[model samples]
Target: MNAKEVKEILDSAKKNDVFLMEAVWTRFFPASVEIRKLLAQGEIGEVKMVGAEYGVPLFHVPRSDQKDLGGGALLGLGISCLQFISMVYNREKPESIQASGICLETGVDESVAVILQYSKNRMAMFTCSAGVHLHGEAFIAGTNGIMEVLSPMWCPTALVVNEKVTQYPVPEPSLPLNFTYSTGMRYEAEEVRQCLLKGNETSAFCLL
Candidate 1:
């Protein structure tokens, strides 16, 4: 759907009794859930900072050049980076946000970097580019050690704790099209289901 339509639907859901939300599939995955638990349990100690990056070259897509389609770094890669930060920080929206981007020929953002400051002096740096190649990984730095999410956006196939790299196998989900192997999306669905069953409007990681 178009941006207007999507916004309307979200509004409708708020007005209605349904829980409407953006489909941020990565936040719901098993690895992500585990990461949250690790943080809560102090396995990673006090989280001091986080760093994440996501980007894609939109050179081949015509819509990428159209601002009306929300074709920009903020809406595209920024969304992904912000979503990643929210998930890592247990769905807490940043207390403050500072951002800047480079505009393209179509007046859309070609690339952007955003700094999010949270409570307890915790900070997250997110970056995205529609004009460059990027290794989409997220890092969580704490006092004791660090946790690394490799491919945190889509497959989310592996996670490394500190210096010891432990890989979790991605479960094959029976889904459609290019989403069949997506462990991230399925995990999010599971979290939603759990929340609904518990009569909770939000997940433990939900900011709102």
Candidate 2:
């Protein structure tokens, strides 16, 4: 998992007192910011569970089906699910994990489902698939109400809160996928630029 290498890099970065960050652009999305606010403001009560799924039909691509080239649904889409959970629950590692997946001949996973249990009875269930076309939806359920991150949750343009279906709008691309991203990536880049200008080691919104 390159865990050791990542740790070393972080340690080195700290020792050198430099800024280093992982490229998870979702954190900078307006929808993401709104979700954080909703949780902090107790709009959804105390979050007890989070579910997320991101899948696309890309099995025909060489870079996706090849193991040596780091092809797998988990490697491709699971990070976003992990990020979604962290955005809700912070950076604490899951206390227990359960996973199952289907793999191709190259031993690369075509699909993966993982359930991560955290302390305080909180849980996160995430699924990523390469052979399927999923809605890329995410759900956050709490004691009082629930929040749904719209389709393509990783870069969604809206969030639906509660049974009343109260919609909170987020910024959308001037033209969908105009810059190779349905959700404009400029917001994240701008955040990074601000951090650099402020000499901050990491973003206040998006953590590595």
Candidate 3:
């Protein structure tokens, strides 16, 4: 979906006075909370750049190469990196975006890379792929120090800031999960619940 579609949805939600939110669960993680706290406290100074990478071996999955299935690296997996960038930039519009990618024979992206340039020399870059497995790491660089999100940055459980490490383990789920750290989704659920209780129409951490 494009900006027009997103704007329409937001407008509709406001007109109807209903709660609306995007389920970008990573932003609800404790690691994410810590990242925000550190930034707010100026522990890392002024953020200059943010970088993230996410990829997995999904070529063997038939839907991964099928355009009709909405199959592509950018659509399926790249959201993690893109959302991370948006979080760091506080949803500010970038000055420009440049992207490049490789596509499968079926014409779906196999690997994608993007660069977002913003004012004051701020920038964000990321890579996502379905053709290969990446290190799945991310970093935020600032004037004073840098912070690194550990592997599987999308659902990160740990972060390193200037040689100091902080870890947030996933909670145990009652049911089995198909992915690692999925129990962290509880945080997202609670966020929605609390918002509804308070008659909120949107989340402070995630905009409509």
| Candidate 3 segments whose C-alpha is farther than 4 A from its true place | 4-8
| lDDT by residue (tens digit), candidate 1, 1-208 | 3778867876786677676545667666677667878888998888989888877787578787689887876677667777777776766768998988888888888889888899999999988888887878888999999988887454466888987776767665555547435545557787788878887655655533
lDDT of each: 0.76, 0.84, 0.92
On lDDT, the stronger of 2 and 3 is: 3
lDDT top scorer: 3
Q: Show how many residue pairs clash in every candidate, following the order shown.
A: 3, 0, 0
lDDT of 1 at 86: 73
Q: In what order do the candidates fall by lDDT, top score first?
A: 3, 2, 1
Q: Choose the strongest candidate by TM-score.
A: 3
Candidate 3 displacement at residue 157 in angstroms: 0.8
Model 1 residue 147 distance off true place after TM-score fit, in angstroms = 0.9
Off by over 4 Å in 1: 1-11, 93-95, 152-154, 173-180, 192-208
Query: lDDT of candidate 2 vs native?
Result: 0.84
